[model samples]
Target: MPRTVPRLVSAIAALATVAVLAGCSTAPSRPLEGYAGEPKGVDAPASSAGGASWTAWLEDGTQFAIVLYGSSTCPPKVQNVAATADDTITATLAPAPGGICTHDIVPHTTVFSTPERITKTAEVKVVMPDTTLTLPTRQG
Candidate 1:
């Protein structure tokens, strides 16, 4: 029976440790999860693409990229994306992480997994806060 005290104390200690660790959380990661990267030609001004923003399907319809143009150092990012219809997508930008950013406009790409509801083979309209881009169906 005396041994039960030590077991009980050990259980409580383990639980406390777990609770403390669970409460401790690291700062949010800078890069969006799933995928984020600066695609090639990022050096070119976004206008070179004849637009300030665009979207594309990547890796055989598994993921999509949202490209936004602004300060290279503090460009807007895609916080989340959803398919409201088989041929439509909505992209929500992450609130700008306020900070000093380069005045120059450059392209930054943020990729998100294609929502299951999206029909990648169809012309998908990406609706954003700024504009709607009609992305032609991806060619095999």
Candidate 2:
């Protein structure tokens, strides 16, 4: 009976360890916000009025913008922003620094101007860790 008890305890410990490791392996959840659809081709220039910063325009004329809310523990770094030949606006956002951020939602603006005018059929795509947001262009 003594040997059986020890074996049972060992099995339980192994199961507990597996459960803890499985929980730790789960990926962190990042909730996304802002519009994720067709962009209304409004001629209004980018402004910080709504806490959204204009990122840029794609070769096909799609507008890109970043909508910021909540306190970021680290500033969101822009790694790359470019217009591809296929008329898609591609952007990569770097991970923020490690720090404590407030719970308040703060809106910030970023504007980008391109020599090329907006195209009626352009699309915007923002890529991040485990997340992708695609915004299509809509006729005004």
Candidate 3:
């Protein structure tokens, strides 16, 4: 009985340790300000029938802003900061994490034109990874 008591106590202790460890584990947290860098130059891409899309890769920051201008009929472009890739116009974007980011703007479905073309220009700002590369509007 004495030996059985010690084994039972040991088992209980092991279970408790496992539970505590499990509880300590959590999903990795994404930092908002962890990315800190500069904005890089901008470039342009070939025009597409659907429309144009702009992308700016951050050089050393976690957030970035992109200004997109469309035709007079389209909505006015504005600047926005991104926390996650989903925060941008496209959810699939993978902005470089940790002090580097990318900004991409795609035309919404509301765009209407026989051969839709963005009449205006796009401005991009990147932050993080310590390098900035701007490509001009490319077809979406």
Global lDDT scores for all candidate models: 0.68, 0.45, 0.32
Query: Which candidate would rank higher by TM-score, 2 or 3?
Result: 2
> Residue by residue across 29-135, what tens digits does model 3's lDDT show?
23222111112343434542234433443332223333232332332232222222212121122332354223433332111111112211342322223333243
For candidate 2, give the lDDT: 0.45
lDDT of 1 by residue, 61-122 (tens): 77766777777678778777666666877777788987777887766788677776666687
Which pairs of residues collide in model 2? 53-110, 54-110, 61-119, 70-105
> Residue-wise lDDT of candidate 2 within 1-140, one digit each (tens)?
99999999999999999887664322322222234321234333354354443443333442344444435444344444444423343455546657686665454323233213334365645444445545565446
The alpha-carbon lDDT assigned to residue 138 of candidate 3 equals 31
Question: lDDT score, residue 128, model 3?
Answer: 25
Candidate 3: give its CA RMSD in angstroms. 16.8
Instruction: Give the local distance difference test score of model 1.
Output: 0.68
Which portions of model 1 miss their true places by more than 4 Å? 1-51
Query: Best to worst by lDDT, what's the order?
Result: 1, 2, 3
lDDT of the structure predicted as candidate 3? 0.32
